[model samples]
Structure formats: C-alpha cells, structure tokens
Target: MKVAFTAPMKPLDHPVPSGDRTMGRLIVRALELAGHKVEVASTFRSWRAEGGEDVTREVKKLALTHAQEISEQWIERGDVPDVFLTYHLYHKAPDWIGPYLCAKFNIPYVVVEASRAPKRQSGNWALGFNAADAALAQADQVVALTNSDAQCLSQVLSKDVLTVLPPFLEEARFEISQSVTKGSADGTIRLLCAGMMRAGDKQFSYMVLAAALKQIADLPWRLTIAGDGPARAEIEPLFDRKRTEFIGLIPWQEMPRLYRSHEIFVWPAIREAFGFVFLEAQSCGLPVVGGRVFGVPDIVEEGTSGLLSDEGDASALAQNLMSLIKNPHKRENMAAAAVENIRKNHSLEAGARGLDKVLHAALERHQFKRKAHGGR
Candidate 1:
C-alpha cells in the first residue's frame, strides 16, 4: 500500500507539540509498521481558529493552492497514491486536498477522527463547518477515536464506514525496562503534567488544575510541568511558584524518564480527545488523575488505572488527587494496571494492526466501487 498521509489541521512537521501533530506522525508510522509505504502528501494547514469572512476566503484560497500543488506533483512523478489518509477533521480545520486528490486518482480515501455537527452549519465557522461536512461525506472510511465521536458521526456516515480507533501511544518509547516499583515513602508525592500551554481549552485545563492544587495546598506534593507555548506568561501565574516547577517543554525522548520518575500524572483533561499524554504516562508505569468527561474515560480505566473527577470541578479533582496521595497501596495497584491496560489496548502495534484491517477493507470497497462505475 502506498499511502499519502496528511494532517491539514497542522502539518506533521509543524514545529509545535500539539496532539494533532503527534497523531499524524503516529498514524504514518503505524501504516509503515503494517508493511505499507507512506508519504506526507502536503504540510499545508487549513486551520482557522476564529472563522469569519476573511478566514473563510483565506481557507478557500488555500484549498485551491493545495489542490493545484498536489496535482502538479503527482503529474510530475507520474505515480498516483494508492490511498489518501487524513487525520483530525473538524469544523475549525477541514481537509480539502485528500477528497479532491482521491477522486482525481480514483483511489481510496479515509479520515481518522472526522467529526461533524449540523448545528455548526450556521455560525462564525459556517464555511469551515460546511467544508468539513463535504469532506466527511466523501470519505470512504471514517475512523472515530471514541464512542462519542462514532455516535456523532454515525448520523452522517454509514454504519460500515464508521469505526472506532482509540487514541494510542508508542509503547516501545515508554516501556519500563526494569521491574516496576512503587514510589518510596519519602512523604513528598510527585505529580507530573505535560501539555502545550496554549489558550482556549488547554489554558482552561491549566486553570482548573491550578485551582485543584490550591484546594489541596496543605498536601505534601510537588508538581513538575513540562511544556511551553504562547500562553506561558498567563499560565505560569495560575500555579503556586513554590509547589510547581515548570520545565518549559522537555524533548520527546526525555518524556519516558520524566513519567517514570513521577508517581502520579495529573491533568484536568477538559474536552480532550483521549489525551495521548495520559496513555504515555500510563505506559511508563504511572497512574493518572483526570476529568471524567469526554474521551478521558475511553483511555483511563477509572478505579483500575486511575481516578476521574467531574469536569472542571476543582474540589472533586482535589479530592481524587488526595485519595491517591493518602493511599499508597491503591496508587501502586493503579500504576501496575495502567501499564498493563496500555500494553493490551493502546499500544502502537495494536493501532497498526487495526489500521491495517481498515486499509484492506477500504481498498476492497474502492475496487468494487470503481468496477461498478465502469472502471472510471
């Protein structure tokens, strides 16, 4: 399989530590692991955070430019892609290249994490929303990362087209080489949180975490935060300087060590699409504490691998943290379970196998459809 993979929300090589970028890289790697050749089709981003007339016009212009550039490259090389795969399609960032190029080449087209909502058709992001809808309708297979995403897309997608592929992490990168041991009785609980300090939901999550920590100020705990973004100045003030140490974006290679050293991973995963960081931490033998809403439940097994509190509830978040802090036995059990759960369900190998199945099915459908249309 020669797969032309793309992430229109943000390019795979975009110099940012975003979830979309991470997922794009993972998906490409997964396809390669499944014995397929993959190439980055384009790094042209079509993301518009605040969509209005100017943004809409810019997105439209970019779409045209992307189509032309990709088409010219295909003609020059004289090798059309066997399959076109896109990641993270939503109202704010819709794909316009994959559908066009796949149609032109008469190849299979698939979308990972494609979402649609009819209510968004009339709003500031009306143009983006409509464009996303158009792309979703054209996709031969739509891979949903969670049941919620599947349910929402089922209304617009056929039952056979909708499938669930949970958020995953590179298990090899985070595997513990030695026997797992519980945190020592040093009496100082160490909590770790890693994420880009961006605005919107990211900032809101940081704010909620800071409030939760404030509620448990008397607890003997230290926090290490690893990430940097545009909102660092604003986000830094939210945490108490004495208890929290901001590392300002550690390298990806160093993340496994960071998680291994920590006892608990805390992040108020507000509106997260099954945060990969949670899986990364778990894979490194660290339990998690996160919100109960959205995709967190899909990743973190409540009461086994970690604990979850109500979304945006500072008190409940603090309480959940306190439970883990006071109960070392429970924390130790959860830590072991965390690693096990990730190995069994959310490993990169698992994701690659699942993708391989989907790709085979999509190819068969594409062949059948083309034959039915007189091999056009």
Candidate 2:
C-alpha cells in the first residue's frame, strides 16, 4: 500500500528533526518498514505558524497550494494508493488538501495524533480549529496516541473506531552520544527537563522547581534544560543561569548522550498528550521524574523508569528529585530498568513493525469494504 502522509507542525522540508518532524518521519519509516510505500502529501514548512494576522493568511494560502500539489503528485504517479495517513493535524494548521483529495477520490482518510482546543478562537487558531474539526469529522480512521486523545477526538468525530496505540518513537537517537561531556557520578546528581517551553507544557512550573531546588543549595546537583520557545523569555530569568545549564534546542540525534550523563529526567508538564522525551531519556538509561499529566502515566512506568508526580506540583517534583539525588542505589536500579523497558517496548524495530501491523490492517479493511461494495 502507498500511504500519503501529512502533518501540521512539521515542515515538509525542515532539516531539523524536532518532536513533530521526528514523529512524521518515524511514521513514514514505520509504513515503509511494513513494506508499504509512503508519500508526504501535504505540509506547511513555515516558522510563522504561531497565531497572528499575517500567519493566518499564509496558512490558508499554503494549505490550498499544498493540497493542489499533493493531488497532482498522486495523480501523476498513476494511482492514488490504498490509504492516506496523516499525523498531528491540529488547530495550528490542518492539511486542508488531504481531505480534499480523499473526498474527490473517495478513498480512506486516516488521521493520527489529532486534538482540539475548541476555545481558541483568535487569528490563525480559528482557521486551524475549523480545518482540524472538519478533518476529524471526515477521517475514515483516527489513530489516537492515548486513550484521552481518542476520547477527545471522539467528541468531534463522534466515531468509535479510533485505535488506542501506544505512542511510538525511534529509540536509536537517544543512544549515548559521545559528544556529551560525561560527568563523574561524584556524589552530585544531574537532572534534566526537556521539551518546548510552550505555555502549559510545564515551563511555568520550572520556576517553582527552581525556587524549591535553590533552597537546597548544598545538594550538589545540576539541573539543565534543553529547549526553546515563546515562553523562554518569560521563564529563563527565573532560573539560576549560574548553576543551571540552559542548552537551547539540542538536536534529537544527540540527546542520548545527554541523557546518559544525567541521573534523572524531569518533566512536570501541566498537560501532556504523551511525553515522548520520557521514552528517549529511558532509552538512554536515565530514570524519569515527570508529572502525571494527560497520557503521561501510560508512558512512564512509575518507580521503574521514573516517578510520576501530580501535575503542576513543583514541590512534589522537587522532593522526588531530591529523593533520587540522595538515593544512589535506587537511581542506579531505575536506570537499568529504564533502558530495558526501551529495549522491550519502545525500540525502533518494534515500533516500526507495530506500525506495519496497523497499516496492513487498514489496507485489509479497505479491501474488505471494497469487496462488500462489489469493488465500487
């Protein structure tokens, strides 16, 4: 089967592999690994995606152009393929072209990792919201990343066919990079919280963690944050730059060595769809310390790879960090478990193969429906 893929946050040509791009790339890899061909049908490769007057106009224009280009590409290639698989087409920007082509061809339209924040009505968000809601309503199948996401998507699509698959990621990138300067385990602990500094992703709570940890000055620990976003300006001044290492936007391929050097991975997200970083950190043999936000409990095995604290509770997150900081034996045990969990559950081979199963299932379903309709 040839799968046409689309994503909202990922640029079709962006060289850097950030979270959304990585997911898009991994999903394409997964389809290919299953012996199926994939075509990235539609994409918006602009940094001006954030809400504004001009961005709204640009997104609409881009969506229209991309849709036409994809339709032409699929047509010129002789066949439209068996299915169309899209990822993360949310309110910021939806692959308006994908739905158009699918509707015209009367083919299966599949959406993965779609969500809606209905209240966002200003500027580009309104257009994104409208596009996403329409796609959710039109999709033949929706692959939800978590149970909660499935539930949320159901509210819009009113469909019960959403698959509740564990969020899959390529673990190879999280391997110990030789570039990261290794730190001696000389009584001091290292902690890291990685993710975009988007509001409500827990960058706000980092201020609280800083305040809490700064109180324990004699603890001999280093906390480094690796990410950048609009919220950085507001959040950066709050943390002590002298002690904390703020490495802005580290490449995805080199994050593993950074994880190996750290003792604990901290993510106190107020709300998270699924923190893929938890899997990355654990893949690099680092224990996690994260908030029990939406879908996070499903990702982090508490007391094994990491401890899941209550969402937004910086005090509790700080305490959990301290416990791991002092308990060397426990941290070491958890680190081993973290790596093993990745090997068993989140490896690239396993994830890509699982993806194969889903694509095959979708193709079979399409065939079955076709047979019932006399190959209509």
Candidate 3:
C-alpha cells in the first residue's frame, strides 16, 4: 500500500531533534520495515503555539492551499495515496492535510499518537483542537502509544479504530552498543539524565532531580547531564554545578554509548507522555527511575526493569535513587530485566509487526465498508 505520511506538529525532515520528530521518523521506518511503500505527503506544519483567532485563521488558509497543491500534484503524476497516515495529533498541532485529502480521495485515514481533549473546543486553540477531533473522527484506525491516551480515545473513537503501540527503539544499534561494556561496578555509581533543558515541565523535572540528588549528597555517584536548550541558565543552577557534569547536547549516534556508560538512568518525568529515553536507556541495560504518573508505568515496570517514585515528590525520587545506589545486586538484576523487557516488547521488529497488523486491518476494513456502500 502507498501510505501518505505526515505529522502536523513537525515534519519528518524537521531539523530540530525532538522526541516527537524522533517518533515520527520511527513510525515511518516501522511502516517501511513492515514492507509498505511510504511517501512523505507534506512537511507543512499547522502548529499553534500561542493561540489566537487570527493565527488559527491564517493556518487554516495555509492548510487549504497546501492540500490543494498536493491534490494537483497527485493528479498530474497519476499517483494518489492508497491510505493516509498521520502522526501526533494534539490541540497545539493537528492534521489539516491528510483528513481533507483522504476524504476527497476516499482512502483510509489513520492516526498515530493522537490525543483528543473535547474541553479545548472553545479555548484559544479551539480551531486546531476541533480540526484534530474531526481528523480522528474520520480516521479508520488510531494507534495509541500509551494506555492513558487509549482510554481517552476509546470514549470518542470506536474500539476497532484504536491500536496500542508501546514505546520502542531500533535495537540493532543499541544491541551492539550494549555488548561493549563501558561503566563498571567500581565504587562510583554513574547516574545519567538526558533531556533538552526546556522551560515548564522539563525544567520542573530537572529541579526535582537536582533536589533529589541533593538529598543523597553523601552517596557515591557522579552525575552526567546530557542536553542543552534555552532554559540551561535556569536549570543548571538548580543543581550543584560542582557535582554534576554537563555534556551539553549530544548527537543521536552517540546516545547508545552514553546510556551504556551510565549505570542508572534517572529522570523525574514531570507529566511526560511516555518518554523514549526511558526505553532507550533500558534497551542498553541500564535501570531507570522516573515518576509514577501518566505513561511512565507503561514503559518502566516497577520493581522490575526500573523503579518509580510518586509524582512531583523529590524525596521519593531520592529514596529510589538511594535504594539503587546502595544495592548493586538489585540494580544489576533490574538492568538485566530492563534489557530483556526491551528485547521482548520494545524492539523495532515488535513495533513493525504491531504497525503492520493495524495498517492491514485498516485497509481491509476500508474495502469492506466501501463494498457495503455499493462500491462508492
């Protein structure tokens, strides 16, 4: 099937390196891995960061123009997409092209990582949120990455339209990286945390981590912080600079080694939507410690692959850190379990298999429905 792939939040080829972009590319790769011919439908982004009526109006106009452009190009080339697939649909950014083009072309429309908040229908992002809701409503299948999102989507979309896809990693590279042992059981416990130093919840998570580390000041550990962003000045000061080593921003290829070199991966995920880092770290055989809220539990198996603390509780985070620091055997056991968990559930092959099932089902259902409608 020819899959028309697009993400309104950010294009797959967007220069900025973010979890959203990473997942978008990963989803594309998974489609290809499943033996599908995928095409980049558009790089146009319909993001409304600071909501306003004028901004919404301008974006809607731009979206319509882009949709027409794609339609014209497809007609000229005589190559219309068999199915329209979109990734990441939220109030801040929503699908404007796929939904329109799919409706016109009578192709199956599918969404990955789509979240709907009906309350936003009258807010600043009212236009974008409604646009997203309409897209999901038209969608033949919606692939959810977390149980929280799945539960919410179930209320709006039919059960057959929802498919749960867990966070995953391209494990071949990580497998090789993990094979080369880096960190050791030498008295020093190497703790690593990596995420862009952004304001809001990200910075809040950093502050909580700093406070947690401060609580365990007496513990034998060397902290490595890997990330850089606009909020660095505010975030770095919260930590004891002398005790923490900053790696600034790192290249994607180097992340596997970084995770392997660290004995533990610690991050107080403040309102995270299932962080890919947790899975990446665990895939490299490092035990993780994060907040026990939202999608954290979906990735990190408590007392198994890693541990979780109560949300926003730095003291609880500190205790979990201390427990891992004090017990080497437990940490090693969790590390083993973490790697196994990734191998069993979060591998690229697993993601590709899951994606194939949903995509194939969508195509089949679309054909069945079309036939039922007298081949319309």
* Candidate 3 residue runs with Cα over 4 Å from true position: 177-186
lDDT by residue (251-271, candidate 3, tens digit) is 988888888888999999998
Best by lDDT: 3
lDDT to native, each model: 0.87, 0.73, 0.88
Q: How far is candidate 1 from the true structure (C-alpha RMSD, Å)?
A: 1.8
Could you tell me how far off, in angstroms, the CA of residue 317 lies in candidate 2 after the best superposition?
0.7
lDDT of 1 at 262: 84
**Judged by TM-score, which candidate is best?**
3
lDDT of 3 at 292: 90
Question: Candidate 3 has which clashing residue pairs, if any?
Answer: none
Which structure is stronger by lDDT: 2 or 3?
3
lDDT of each residue in 250-308, candidate 1, tens digit only:
98887787898889999998888778788888998889999887678999999999999
The superposed Cα distance between candidate 3 and the true structure at residue 16, in angstroms, equals: 1.7
lDDT of 2 by residue, 1-376 (tens): 7787767667546765455666677777767777888877656542344776567667668777877877777688778867787787677766677687877776777877777676865554776677678887777667777777777776766444467667666665665435554345575678887877767646666766666676666787888899887798888887777778889898666677777777788877666677778878888778888888878777677888888788777778778888888888888899899888878876667767766666666566656767898987
Work out how many backbone clashes candidate 3 has.
Answer: 0
Off by more than 4 A, model 2? 15-17, 45-62, 118-127, 156-160, 176-185, 197-202, 228-234, 368-375
